[model samples]
Target: MAESIIEQIRALEVLDSRGNPTVRVFVTLEDGTKASASVPSGASTGEHEAVELRDGDASRYGGKGVRKACANVNDIIAPELVGLDASEQAMIDRLMIELDATDNKSRLGANAILGVSMAVAKAAAQSRCDDLYRYVGGSEARRIPVPCMNILNGGEHADNSVDIQEFMAVPLGAPAFSEGLRYVAETFHTLKKILEKRGLATSVGDEGGFAPDLGSNEEAIELILEAIEKSGYEPGVDIAIALDSAATSFATDTIGLYDLKWSGAGRMRSDDLIEMAERWVEKYPIVLWEDPLGEEDWEGFVKFTKALGEKIEVVGDDLFVTNTKFIRRGIETGAANASLIKLNQIGTVTETVDAVRLCIENGWRAFLSHRSGETCDTFLADFAVAMGSGHLKTGSASRSERLAKYNRLLEIEDALDGNALYYWK
Candidate 1:
């Protein structure tokens, strides 16, 4: 076996789908194998998540530029990792973590560290002449995830009337990944026509979901149901509804109180929201609900999960932040049955995989995810298959950045031929 030694690491400032400057890292192995990875940003980020370093220079990119992070990759991380084996992902990540020294990676920036980490993994996979999924997950990595395609936008992802951040269509009934993608893609187009017929805006949000100012958050689900039926799919059987409340966006300082200002439903208690969720869950074919309560409202989460955990996937997004400590706490408390997993949320592939392991080991689901702002990089697509989490939520079907992952999955499914598994659970 040849050693894939890290030769050079460099980061370039690049624009994400949201037009914000992000870090794109390039890694060259000793054998001349080169690979690059892009770092994605989140609009509704967790308060306790690893901090992303920015230029803070208001003149460039509205103080959102990641030039400082890029510098950290080029000037600091490159020197120490040059001689190390790129295949030793955990060691490389640990060395970078020590260099950062901050608990949330505030110094060198998670963006900088993660970019290099991902690029190193890609370079190593290329050097090994293996797919990213095979390199990371071995021969057992053949399960294709059921994409929770967010076809409608609200909350932080859009300027709209709905309070819920995302309304996703889960194509769990499709036999293969390509057919499943086609099912949702056809539904997305049908949804567009329905919205147009209703004289609503056909414009898209950050995640490529429709951003029409609808009557109510519940109405958004109704519209999607119509689209699914119109597209010749049965709701809950062929496709199911998934919601991401992102309650922290509307959560007040008072732990249980929330200001649902987006939908003009102003100020409601956690109990009220929980009851509302119960009613909606019973009424709709909802299979998953994320961020039902605020990050700080742990008691509310426990209560909410108790009411609906057995029926649906009560996911912790901001609640866990892709950290094992928080995930462990949630597992102990039974706060959620699943968690949203993102590489950048935890700052390293090793840590992100650790989070997935922790969730699965606890008999909980690990739901792979993409940030609100993304890129055309298909690392996440391979990662979803690698993790074998069975489900993922990567934006809507419209945006090219979002479609990139879905398209990559199609390629992998084709390549896998008869071995790939596709399902919701």
Candidate 2:
């Protein structure tokens, strides 16, 4: 028996769904098995996330070109990683981190490192003739996540007046993952029709969700509920609502202050924001609220969690950034009851997996997420099931980039051959 080793590694600059430049990596094993992975970027990115290298030239793509990151992968990372055993995931990731030797992977670029990391995992699975979930998570990877399908978009994701970053639909009553996706997709279409009939702009945001200037956040909630009902689903019973405030987008330097430019409501204090959120929670059946406070406002997080954490999932995205240290800090401070897991935020599959494990170990819910600027890579779909995270937020039920993930989950469900277990089940 011969060991499968990395025979070659290649990288290139690719355009994400948002038309932004991103890095894609290809890994080939000695046994001729090959796998490729692309990295996604975030618009409302956290301050503490790993560095994504970009070309600073003002002439091309407004300095967003990832040619430099691509070069780093080809010239730097590939040389260091080639010939290593493809099955050694943790070891490969650790070596990449050490080679970078920066707190945030600034030298080689997280985009480059993460691309290789994910590609290697995929290649290892290919070499073993196993699904990614089985290869990465072993026998325990059976739980299919409940999709948190975003139906409406606001904040930095859209050019609209709605303040909420994302308004999502969760199919909690569906018996299978595929059925749950269908329910959400129908609701998304129904919502589009409602928006169109109301003479609202049905343009999609960066994450494939409708971006309509609905005047108020309350209106967004009402429209979503109406859409669910119109789609023949019972709101709060068959399907539930979730929100991603992305408050850091409007966070000001002054503590407890926020500038909501969209609502024309001007600046609001932390207490007022919490009160508004509480009112919504009371009025609507929102099962999850993510980043309801600014990343730097630990006190606000504590207050919000203490107020409504028991009733709804107070998830931390910018607050945690999929970093274990920050996750531990959030745990100690009672900042949030759940953590959003974005693989690119941590820059490696192993580190991302570690973060999910930490959340699970501490009884905190883990939700695998996709970036607003995404590719057609369906990695997160497998990853969510593999980790048994039970929840997934991968944009809305539109766009090829977003649909690729949902469609892949459907295929996985079929492949599971009756062994699949959905989150609702």
Candidate 3:
């Protein structure tokens, strides 16, 4: 146990996939075991999420520098956490939360706190010579998530006219993680070819999904479905569609009134958006609808859930922010059927798991997810399996950063030795 005690912690300012400055934390144990983790940034961040600290210096990284966060980890957080046991993950996380003493980790920066939290867990797992999933989720952690490949991008993630943020292809019927990955990877290729045939741009967005100027949001779905069928797969049975409206991105002006400026759909009330969802769910093989309503639109969410909750999974991303407090509200109010779990949203691994437990224990599902700006670290793949969350949305098949997660999941499935499970339910 003494050997697993933390000996040193440090942080460095690093660049995310978007070339913006972010925090990367490293931890060293007394026994010479070391691990590191990089924090991901969200382009479409929610209003209530823990603050990702950034240096306001306009000179460095265009004011997105995270040197303050790195300093917090090296100067303050590192000194206090040095002698703690790496294996005491929950206690260590709680201590950090207390140290911050802020509601949203605004002072210390979620980037700083989460980087350390993730590195400590990775170091502990290395010290035990165990996988991170097994270390955090016990030995039963072998459920590889059904990958929801974001093949089409819109809203904040893309400059296209389409309003939906993410249009994903879920290979729910695939026998295993590797096969499922292959299935979607093939579909991604097919979609690109189809777009080229129609004279659309094959360029991708921040999350690597194609960002072509389409006629409308529904047209993106049409292209994806066509690709799924053309790739020798059935629509709903073999591949299901998932969406992330990321409504908060568009919810910039008002609380209840939504401005559909990107799609030219005009300003709409909550009911109008709900009606469109009802139509889409009936028309397409849509299995999941994320953030159908904005974060503060609780009543609208409940109404949206009631309308389509039985038909599909109504997921809350910005609505929940991977925090147990808002997840509890969603659970109690019947606002959403599931929550999108992002590790950095809540600033600590323990709280992120707590959010998942809150959702699952209350008969709701957890959709482990990645941010738009991501790192090559495969912690998310292990985390999705660890939580037994049936699904995860990384990105399209093009970028190496996105593929890194899928490649890691393939490795994990093999590591499970025929014991791994994959499903959407």
Highest lDDT: give the candidate number. 1
Give residue 126's error in model 2 in angstroms.
0.1
lDDT of candidate 1 over 134-236, digit per residue (tens): 9998999999999889999999999889899999999989987788888888999999999999999999999999999988888999999999999999998
CA lDDT of every candidate: 0.93, 0.93, 0.93
Candidate 3: regions farther than 4 A off: none
The alpha-carbon lDDT assigned to residue 121 of candidate 1 equals: 93
**1-425: candidate 3 lDDT, tens digit per residue:** 59899999999998888998889999999999999999999999988999999999999877899999999999989999999999999999998999899999999999999999999999999999999989988999999999999999999999889889999999999998899999999999999999999999999999999999988888999999999999999999999999999888777567778988899988888999999999999999999999988888999999999999999999998988999989998898999999999999999999999999998999999999999999898899889888998899999897888989999998899988999988879
Q: In candidate 2, which residue pairs clash? A: none
Q: Write model 2 residue lDDT over 295-336, tens digit each, in one string.
A: 998899999999999899999999999999999999999999
| Candidate 2 Cα deviation (angstroms), residue 359 | 0.2
